[model samples]
Target: MATVAATKPAETPDEQTLREDLAAAYRLVAHFGWDELIFTHLSVRIPGPDHQFLINPLGLLFEEITASSLVKIDLQGRPVGDNTQPVNPAGFVIHSAVHAAREDAQCVMHLHTVAGTAVAAQRDGLLPLSQNALLGWDDLAYHDYEGLAVETGEKERLVADLGTHNLMILRNHGLLTVGATVADAFVRLFILQRACEMQVAAQAGGADLIHQSDAMGHKVAAQGRAAFAAGAGLSWAALRRKLDRLDPGYRA
Candidate 1:
């Protein structure tokens, strides 16, 4: 069985900070062309024992999501307050499963990108075909597709498939990633998505692809874990600056 390097918890950001960070993530997803017409979801768990989290309001594009516009919801995916913003049912099923089951997974991100879904459709899953793939090679997990994720029973299977890994390719569905913070999850999804893109491009060429040795792959995976453990916040800060230049409305 594979294991992910455990991440030490950083000081918990207040609810406002988490909202801003998640809002920034939604914008970044759109900025990178990862949004699927607002079909996918990104969520961050709020601190305290209430098990509440924030998600994008339904019917809004990723670019249009702002910190104040996010909706706070409970583990059952129901809104916690008088906020009546529509929530995505599928998003609730997928994200609530992770947030409820994993204490380490403070933030969860799921996406339906062309390359990610294409790779998920393959029987072989993500190959160690690129440095990006190798970065998450050992940490990757897969959940067999069970049609649309609106069914609540699928939560058990989803958590089982995800196990301890932070990076997952939902077989025949899309990609899912979790982290101790929004930055951790987003950085992981970025790596996993890039790997899928590289795999798709390489396979399209119809040429023999080089496979790295398991020993070397492990080495690279360890290097990646260390880099993320050290710099996820730094990467996310830089990304936030980029978002600031692009459209700072997400912080509103």
Candidate 2:
């Protein structure tokens, strides 16, 4: 629970949208059972030049989160409000690294879902065994586990390993994905988690694996991205619609 220096209050429509999108992502992650008992974090950059971001209050479960309940913090992982809930220091370590180094990482998602962690523990990492795996292809990064990721010193190494990749598998830990938008990050996680599950299940059967060629994998990933960018293309509007149909209270 580090405290951030207070700054003058500022408000805008873009900030509001950022807050709403971040909240929607939390709810969606919870819906998919990717949350880890209020531990895992999903963060989005505020619509400003300042290195500000929004994350869930530490005490609240992902499903219980609402836009108003989300906490704002600086790059140093300090809470910006009067709220008393402790922020996860380790999450700051992981998120700040990406936010600081990768300008395109507008949204950073980390999860401890069963399938994700199970895949991380495997020696071969994410196998190109299925179409879902191809979405990641050779673009995925891997980082060796270093306890709970609480050390500031780990940031450099983490960034080095992540090096221009959006998907990262924290070996023996969990998974991380970054995106230019909340929708993109969510879709990436969805595909990454699916790939992990497929790999685990395929291995469980102890049968020979059917791997995709590198060129085909890259092509599939390119096509998937193109398909996503088509039309409204996984826009926050669509996600909001899904939330409204299921649990509309995330805007509260």
Candidate 3:
């Protein structure tokens, strides 16, 4: 039998909270066109001795994801407890690698937005051309792409490539980010994608780009940390309120 399928689901309170937050992330990503049909994944680790986590079901649209609709899975991406939903091999391959290695990465988000992919395919990769890029200054990594990310062997190489970085630009692929919280991951992805969009747009104009010195970048990042932290949590709540106004079904 294959390993990445289900056992059952316990659906405890803490796990349930993780489910809602992850589902909220899926909904936000879909609302912003950051979702690629059901290809990419956003997962949050469940609190326990075991390294289990919550991920969206493989076939569901991001907008269709609900708290109870999420699948609980192990590090291998197999369903835990009584879940029947199938897990995405790609999600397991990438997310489990980081979760196993980084205690800081409680939430992992992988996205395939147009801007992120466009910038990633560039040889230089995420030029420090915009203030948005400063959000991840001195805190980014790059991993050379290795096809569709299916083999278990690729997991080790990918995690090694990721190292201690919270944000990674997968060469010729897309953007990846991990955070201690769902809000943090979402904000990092938001800033990275915005940076990519600005870079691609600026380059399209064929204008001479001006980049800040690394020292200036570091200084600006440090200055922005407090506001960035507050804004991420604040904007997340605002967006959740917007979601509730539009369609609160994700909170199910």
Candidate 4:
């Protein structure tokens, strides 16, 4: 497990900040071309004991999502309020599994991109073909695709497969990442998706690829973890500035 920076309970972010941050994640993911139309989901748990969360409303493109447009739901995926916005039950099935088991996973992101899903289809998961892949080498887990993840029973198996890893590649499906904050999760997902993209490109080259040794990979993994933990927030701040300049509506 990577060393997560200590965040005291008193410093828990308010719901408004969490809402804007999570909304920004959706915008950024869409900006980077990682969104699968209006299909995939990103969620952030509100600070409380209710197991409540904020997620993009169904039928909205990631780019169209605004903080005020986010839907609030309970653990069972039911809307906490009037339930005007559509919520995807499949998203609930996938996200609730992680939230149930991992208390630290305040924000969860899952996506289906070409490189990410292409790598998931392979027999071997992410290969150590690039430094980006090795950064998350030790923290990655694999879960076999079990058809549509709408069945509630699959949650148990999903959580079991995830175990302690923060990154998971759903075989023949897509990618999933968890984080203590939306910024951390977004950064982790960015590196993970890049790693998969690099692996796919290397494999397509039809040439021998360099695979780093486990001993060296572990050392690199440690450094990667520290760097991400230390700098992800800074990157988020910078990116959020860009987002603000581009369109500040996401903060609504």
Candidate 5:
């Protein structure tokens, strides 16, 4: 019989927190059924200047992930430590491009959720039809799909397409969001995903849509920013608690 290898020890506090947050995000996505069979990705920046980032191991379902199982990799898409698990190179390419080009992107999330992809395929793409859509008004960018996003040469174009936007609709593909913190990114994705779902459902009803004016959109977006800021701390704390209640094993 083959012998089992020894497992690694527990993570340090800082690393532990990062892992827990990342794992929680994964679980949250999984709970919502947004995960695409390990095809999508959510990445958090490492705290140091080593330019390392953490991502989910390729074979594990999002719900199966624990804090210790997240893999750390350099900006160049190379594994930073002794992570025996493989990563999805295509997903890494998209993430690495953003991380390398955008210093502000501390966490990057990409998803192929049904609603998001449905919106991406629409000609207008994320219409300003709802309050949630306003959160991305003038803030959402678009990047035309270029195959599977695995080419190193695509990084430049991807960055160019993203520009200064915090959210992007990967045209004919899916959605992407970046933030200064994990909570920020996750929240942005949540709003964007909801907006997409609402749009698709509204379109299915065959009712004429009411589009918000640019001024109204901007005003609502500013309010959203304030609201998000005012409640973010508590909200994140609550979200972490929810994760703990559901699966305290993530912290391990």
Candidate 6:
């Protein structure tokens, strides 16, 4: 059997480490072509009672995000500490709602990928047309798009739409996923994105799509539960290694 990398350290990570992880997620999103220029955002909540989180600074592309450059901000979306980097208001509005509402949502990733938005536009939303789709089938939620997500009032509706689910498709907007860790959230987004891509490709052929029955959905869910029991640490480790080879600047 091949050896795998460790998922995380034994001790709780400090703010700096969290910054690096979130930065890696940004770079990975860019690397995978999921980034929409300087739009869309990924954030991780700081472990404290102040309801703080780290997000990409405005006006920078995803590839430009670095650990040291991540801006820490308060719940009201004000930059914390001496960091003067301005954050995207839309990013804060969406991310803050999740961080404040759900304790398990330590990390939240939202993207405006072509396939993701395409699926969101479809009446059926994400279909169980592929294996990756099954991974999120059980935990999926849907939120109707409310303009650009800049209003504070949208936070209440966004949280209400997200509810208890970790995976969400912001209708006619894009994809969103939350997790207990950065790795978990990234992996969930990966699955959701790939599923959307596959669905779009399959639909283009104009062929009748194969839909998995409810029984198969349950079976895949069980198998996924067993297979990913160790969580997304190993996958994250491999991706980090790949990033190290490609561009390790995010760690800076």
Q: Judged by lDDT against the true structure, how good is candidate 6?
A: 0.87
Error of 2 at 36 (Å): 1.3
Going through the candidates in order, what is the number of backbone clashes in each? 0, 0, 6, 0, 0, 0
TM-score of 2: 0.91
RMSD (Cα, Å) for all candidates, in order, is 7.3, 3.5, 3.5, 6.7, 2.6, 6.4
- Give the alpha carbon lDDT tens digit for every residue of 1-252 in model 1: 111121122235598889889999999999999998868999999989999998988888898888777888899777775556778999999999999999999999999999999999999999988999999978999999899999999999999989999999999889999999999999999989999999999999999989988888899999888888768889899999999998898886
Cand. 1 Cα-lDDT: 0.89
- Per-residue lDDT of 94 in model 3: 90
Segments of candidate 6 deviating more than 4 angstroms: 1-13, 229-231
- What is the C-alpha lDDT profile of model 4 across 120-192, one tens digit per residue? 9999888877888888878999999999889999999999998989899999999999999998889989999
Model 5 ranges off by over 4 Å: 1-12
* Candidate 4 RMSD computed on C-alpha atoms after optimal superposition onto the true structure: 6.7
Q: Pairs clashing in candidate 6?
A: none
Model 1 pairs in collision = none
Expressed as tens digits, the lDDT of each residue in 146-233 for candidate 5 is 8998888888999999998999999999999998888888888999999999998998999898998989989988888877754655
Model 2 per-residue lDDT tens digits across residues 190-251: 88999999989999999888888889988988877667654234455787898989988777
CA-lDDT, candidates in order: 0.89, 0.83, 0.85, 0.86, 0.85, 0.87
Residue pairs with colliding backbones in model 3 are 7-81, 8-81, 8-82, 8-83, 9-81, 9-82
TM-score of each: 0.93, 0.91, 0.93, 0.93, 0.93, 0.93
Best by lDDT: 1
Off by over 4 Å in 2: 1-10, 82-84
- In the range 216-242, model 3's lDDT, one tens digit per residue, is 778767876758778989988898888
